[model samples]
Target: MSQIVTLQAFLDHWAGSDPEKAAIASTVRTIAGTGVGIADLVARGPLEEGLARIHGSDPNGGGDTQKELDVIAEEAICAALREAPVAYLASEESEDLIALNPKGQLVVAVDPLDGSSNIDTNVSVGTIYSILPFTEADRDNPNAAVMKPGTNQLAAGFLAYGPATILVSSLGNGTQVFVYDRESSEFIMARDQVEIPVETREYGVNQSNMRHWDEAMSGWIKDCLAGKEGPRGKDFNMRWVGSMVADAFRIFTRGGVYVYSSDKRKGYENGRLRLIYEAFPIAMLTEQAGGGATDGKTRILDITPHHIHQRIPLVFGSKGEVEKIASYY
Candidate 1:
């Protein structure tokens, strides 16, 4: 049988009363409590009356349609953090930053229900979150405080709602994964200090956009397609889940690279994923797991966000694979 280590037990053991560590543990627990509830609604799916994807564009002006569950999940997360040590809550579903407790000392950036496009399809999706210490100096200037560089994140995590709910996170230490054990109604620590393999034969990208790819990207694709005859001298497998967290979960499980880069298509120049909520947190988690994350040119954690919803290109996973792709740029 798998060793049963509960989330609370893990946090209690790791935090052990350090103020910052305790705060981080508390904040993570708060969000996870709601995640458990969100998972229940997700499992109900179509059977739940009036539970449907909200058609049309998102209220945040994003092209994607907001789903019913997305709103519920966002509200639940917001409510959960209202008393936590979180001063500001920035969400993908919200147009502006939410002011929580004035005395709180941290900021939370989240995509409440990411990959909403797959909501109706019953495919994998998740909630991505980043926790950063609120800069007291810039407290009055929410923009400045919220736009801190990804390197400043104190903790980051994501709840992948799929075949089995997995809560993966890091508290500036190492990444760990917790599996939801329904029998005990707890998230059990299944893996600690997860390290991604240094090499991988698989890669994930959207092949439908091949025509819009830049020369460097096109060339890289050509080499991979060439298989044994290619410069890589080995065959490659391609996988695309059309969902960031789903793809990331696969990369964490084995070892693979997932890229959503700036193509020539309009509005895609900067890529699709939001930097603060999606890319930045994922980058932190990937690195904590002994992998790498970059934007073809610059490291993800090194990029400073200029706005709450800034988008960016992302290439992440195994170190060598990430570096090899960056060379093309």
Candidate 2:
């Protein structure tokens, strides 16, 4: 098999294959640039002190509180993409889509800083992004392009700024992981063509929201909690890190499931995870990793996005576990 040493090397291998591959390479190159800056900011300690010193409390359209680093990360990503072939940009930090380059050929949707709520606690957070083709009609109405379904995404990925900065991505090829080499200032391939186990005995969910869940979801959780006494007659374990990127990384490393479903709570009927950025990109990566991603009743990639900031329920991870949850729905 061909050895894939670095992210640029991997992209170059693909770029040699086709024009579409070349475009993807260029876009991901820009994302990597932003990732470097984000890693640096994350590595520096005492984010809370900087948060208090740099900015006041400000919330995004989704009503999630944004920290100072969130804004800084968003700016860095936007700056990197400005010179890329990105025509329309949709971000979690922005209320609406922003047209960056009229003549560009790609549309990007991003969650500049996911899990920012954990920043103060010194927990892991990351950036998520989805890249779609920029069409002629999109030039006429950019929001239309920005609202394209996850199925339309040509590439999707996330940068996890944890103990070691990692970039997990898929370009309709397969899920791959790259770890940042601080000494080299490059992202080196750590895992290639990664796959999630078909079955798992572990699951991750926010148990605090149990009271607000509907019957189907509640029933599923009950079954999981029952362990050996449950319907499956096997023991199970639960995990929740309150950070999607961190949770996702664990699922990728080991076979498991992660659920963030809709509930009876206000503003949560359609779920809280953003479709274009958060759910879509993760869905793409999960599917590419031989896992599954759904909204309890439907495949996440198959859902037609109606708005740029549309939110949806997300249940993803090991194929069997995800399928089992969908069965309950």
Q: What overall lDDT goes with each candidate model?
A: 0.88, 0.87
Candidate 2 lDDT, tens digit per residue, 259-320?
A: 99999988899899988889999999999999999999999998898877788999999999
Candidate 1 matches the true fold with a TM-score of: 0.96
Q: List the residue pairs that clash in candidate 1.
A: none
The alpha-carbon lDDT assigned to residue 112 of candidate 2 equals: 88
Alpha-carbon runs more than 4 Å astray in model 2:
1-4, 52-60
Most accurate candidate by lDDT: 1
User: Each model's TM-score?
Assistant: 0.96, 0.95
Clashing pairs in 2: none
Top-TM-score candidate index: 1
